[model samples]
Target: MKYNFDEINNRLGTYCTQWDYIEDRFGEKDLLPFSISDTDFKIPKPISKTIQKVSQSELYGYTRWNHEDFKGSIAQFYKRRHDCEMNLDWIVYSPSVMYSVSLLIRLLSKPKDKVVTLNPMYDSFFTVIQDNDRQLESHYLQAQNGTYEINFSLLEKQLKDATIFLLCSPHNPTGRIWTYEEMEKIISICKKYGVKIISDEIHMDIKLKENKHIPLLSFLDIYDELYTASSCSKTFNVPGLIGSYAILPNSQVKDEFLHMTRKVDFLNSPSIFGMYATMVGYTECDDYIDQMNDYIRKNMEYVQQFLFENLPDFHFSMPDGTYLGWIDARNVPFTSEQIQDAFVHVGKVAIMKGETYGKAGEKYLRLNCGCPKAKLEDGLQRMKKAMDWLYNNQKGGGPKE
Candidate 1:
């Protein structure tokens, strides 16, 4: 099936966080937004069709998450796409992966227990840990030639004191997919320290060329403490559906985890449409994913070339997976806040500042390139305009405060 990935979907009036909430959040109206991780493209037609069919039933009611269809679809997707098999019995449905992470942290450790992860991570990981009263520790990933790698020595030291290690595979913001060798080292270190691993592989399906998403489950044989959370929300662009799942082997840990999920009333029930959408998304939409990855790869390349040629002060690395581009703006003669203000006020564009990710993201900003080529080009042009304004300000007198 030919997927129309280039189709532009106007999200105005849709209450989209990426599009509609920009003005309210940033105090700038009519600005082009490339901030959030959500894609501007439409979900797969087959998945949408399934959602519509479910909606037409008008019988939305209590639904069970342990059905064969849901489990089978998830199992087949992992086994077929990534060459990893997840037994249906090991799957547990959750409202969202973030919720699962929060609950997992609560179940796995006591308050004030250290939760370690990489710096320049998804902000929500920090939020979840702090919200649950856990001490958050970061092992910074070294940026080598614009790409990122784990500083395993630092990680090992941190893991010695930590109780849980939260990992973002095919990491967020920078989008560095850990190699098998890297994964082995991480697993070995965590195993040595007896720190439980919570792997978030939500962006696993967004692989670019020559890069494959390796599920943490592939190492499950060697390490049983690893728990993985993933969802169709990212792959199928259905986050609003509020569906995600965790994969665990049939063991005592799985038993404890499931028991805690019920005891705490976390993700007690499943969404009626969310369940159907997830099943359909995992079973179908394989080709759509391929086409989406290709389009996003082109967008990444286009923005990389555009920034190099037009906005030379901006530094960006091509991501291995995901639609987000982590850009370094330290060379630009402006603070991160000033750069953000210039983009909104001068260039009429809105993007995520690096500060939100942590101190490691000081002069960086994350840009979403999942939209059509025209929109991506327009955003690049706006970025160029912003850079030009900064340049003119620098040359004429001084940068505007």
Candidate 2:
């Protein structure tokens, strides 16, 4: 293979949240950090070159949003990749997905209004709701048949009085790429309750398999009250650029959101460099992305096999999309803190504590599998060894299923 994913790319001193802050975050410098979602790989050549070209320019003044920058590349990407048609007028710029969510929440709902979301979801949804002085109601995703499923009956009940719903497509941590049928049911319930949907699809392009991404907007007509927040950051490993777009089709919804943003002057002009990089990523980096997907899939498969063969105490399903793997460690004899400690102190590996997502995530951990194959293998070996020692050295007894 011409591409090299074997070498250990140094990220420790790069001010990377995944690496540089591990000591401060976990209170140990030796933690083999895997908590953050950023990838360890270097940026693609095309994107790098574009950024370099933009850097060479001397002037850094107030910039304007070009129609070409906002539309053509993304519109083509969605239409070709997901079969969803988008118009230029439907797009709005935001610095990040979280910002868009917060703005939309402030626009669509008033203080004390209820917003609904699935438990074991991205934590930002909860923050956005609280930051805007709104009430948040969570319906936990049922773990049945070894996969997470939305309990439509419970969801319908929750949506009855909710004013807004936050949907995480190809959901974070769990990696369940929502099917069209499930989405339709959600839409039907929301429509019944007059609830507007804010779907965060930031991880839509990082599929590890043949399952195609379906934009929730595609299920409804142009007049549907759906807003999509997405970015090339996750897909292209450019989160540092701080560029994202929100897709709102309903004119009233779009206008209201814009009005909210204007109050704070949230007109974030994407850096010319970031714009160039995004265009190159969407238009020219297909093969590179395919290679990345293949690598992540293989790493996930390796983790799955190791867990099945060596450590049967834990339960996890391989992610269908995104580089995050959600593992259930409840059957192991450790508290969430203990599990986190064991991984960092004993195993010299670090992973996200699932409790960060919500209460239902207490005994679970989210591991990022976007690193090199060798790094993943090393981390898994450390984890397996730690688990074995913990179980064998147990004084009382192991946990029950």
Candidate 3:
């Protein structure tokens, strides 16, 4: 591979969120962190080169992102990569995907209107929904045989009065890429109930398998009120760039959205560097996507094998997508809080406590595998030590092989 996925680069003292800001999230410092979602790999050369070239010009200015160069990059990307027809006029820019989601929730529905989504979902969804004064109706995905499936029967009930349905494709936390049949079921129910659909496809480009993501926009023919919030940020590891876009192709919805961003918030212009970075990422960096998947897949395999051999009580499956490893420690003798204390204070390694996602996630733990294999090996060892400490101390010095 042209990129070095094995090099151990130090990120300390650089104000890096995963390494330097552990205290903010975990309330402790100096522990090995597998906490945040970003990766340790360097971004594709094309993106960095473009940013550097632009910086050399020494010109900074407010810029519009509604034009073809910005939106066209996104449209062309989806057309070439995902085989979806994206209209240039339907495209609108936002500083981030969640920003779009928060605005769409307001524009598409009213305060106190019910927003239905799968529980144990991405953590930010909880904050985004509740903070917006929207009532949340969780139609949780059922876990079975090392995978999760949406509970459609309960979903229909939840959507019956719901004004919006927020979806996470190639879902975060659990990492199950929605199949066509599953999506069809979701769409059919929403259609019957006249519910609007808003999908966050940020993880769509992080494909770890042969199945291509059927973009929510692809179902525009079946449901016109559909919208998708996505970015090349996750695919290219450029979330710090502060760029994302939304496909709001419904009647007057785009106009209302622009009013919110342009009129109310003065977010009419995007960061020039971030917009350029996104354009180059979609246009010139296709190869990096495949290489990244290959490296992440290997890291995931390493985590699986190491856990099976060393921490058998931790049940994990190779997620269909994303760099996150969701492990079920329900069978472990210790409670979630016990294991969390062990992971932080005892093992001195920070792994995300599953309960943060939702109550359904309480029995699980999420590990960020988007790092160099050497780093991943070290983090896994820390996890093992945490578990070993739990066993030795909690079980009165239980014997082991």
Candidate 4:
């Protein structure tokens, strides 16, 4: 309770994409953005203090990627928080999880090889696959009353021809934490068909329930066809820090990733401040996560209540993990573009259009609820106004301007 989550910090002049570039990004001058994944709250005090102390020394030299403190801190964090044991040798530094995923795709598969993933996944995976000249294939996750389930039969069929499977643990947009049984089936299917597995566990630390986040690395004993990329960025609200690490247990695959990395000179040196931030986050900010989870739970409750009371036509399930709220607005009788326009032009608020995730996400909106309660309330009011306008204008009941 020592850290205050209710206070709103001014982010206007800092060139923050969330606050300052709303007009440029969404084509509106007064729209409030609830789209991006990063939180509006300030980071833990320890992180800022560490960075400040390091920066005051002004020793911005090239940071070594093989530092023991960095690896040890990450290892100990996994042990303490997730009860997962990880050897320091299994870890390798990268600029970011996305960067590591791109390299892994290239290393594990060739051009034109099909990479399969679940629909409504992290949007970046589509770009990474296409930009690397690989075929992007997806199977939709079945939604029943707002919860999502995987179609194992279709997944197995896809794995028959797939070269790699990209998985989002505590999945984005939907925020369903994959259970052990589900992960086991996925691993078995991939193992049967010789498909390499790449798991993105960046949001593993942010969960609502106990034992919800089953670390993919913990399954290494049963399945060796796995690789994981995670970071402290999402955990500590420091995406701009630009640092992540990859866990590859297989020696050959690890060497291949390293070879590709060195050939292109990708991730050759570490970020000076990013390294400090990661070390401090893992070592000194353990209790900070517990506090963050409590604040996030309250934010989630606020959104749920606001939608139930004011926008009953919209349906959203409370996510088991992550700070995002996936709202199903299919009953609104409008296309995704129309709904987005309403959110932008009518409501003066911005949220992520569902189509960005994939076809399955059409007519849906992803709301980032990681902001102050007052700001979230304002956004809810704006959305209600837009929805009211839509209903009245369509029914010939709204006031004419």
Task: Report the number of the highest-TM-score candidate.
Answer: 3
Query: At residue 252, what lDDT does model 2 achieve?
Result: 86
TM-score versus the correct structure, for each prediction: 0.96, 0.94, 0.97, 0.96
How are the candidates ranked when ordered by TM-score, highest leading?
Answer: 3, 1, 4, 2
| Candidate 4, superposed: residue stretches over 4 Å from native | 395-401
Q: Model 2, range 312-352, lDDT digits (tens) per residue? A: 87787777799999988888767776566667767888888
For model 4, what is the alpha-carbon lDDT of residue 114? 98
lDDT of 4 by residue, 61-121 (tens): 8788786899999999998988889889889988889998998898899999999998998
Q: Write the per-residue lDDT of candidate 3 for residues 69-98, one digit (tens) a residue.
A: 998999899999889997899999899999
Model 2: which ten-residue window has the lowest total lDDT?
392-401
TM-score of 1: 0.96
**What is residue 287's positional error in candidate 3, in angstroms?**
0.8
lDDT of 3: 0.88
Highest lDDT model number = 3
Expressed as tens digits, the lDDT of each residue in 1-401 for candidate 1 is 88887888899999899888888767977889888788888889998888888889898888898888998999999999999987889998888898888878887899999999988999998899998999999887787898887888888988998899999988998888888899999999999989899999999999875768889999988888889988998888899988899887847667777777677575558898788888888887899998999889989999989999998888887989988899988887778877876788788888889888988888998998888999988988888887788777764443354
Residue-pair clashes per candidate: 0, 0, 0, 0
Clashes of 1: 0
lDDT of 1: 0.86
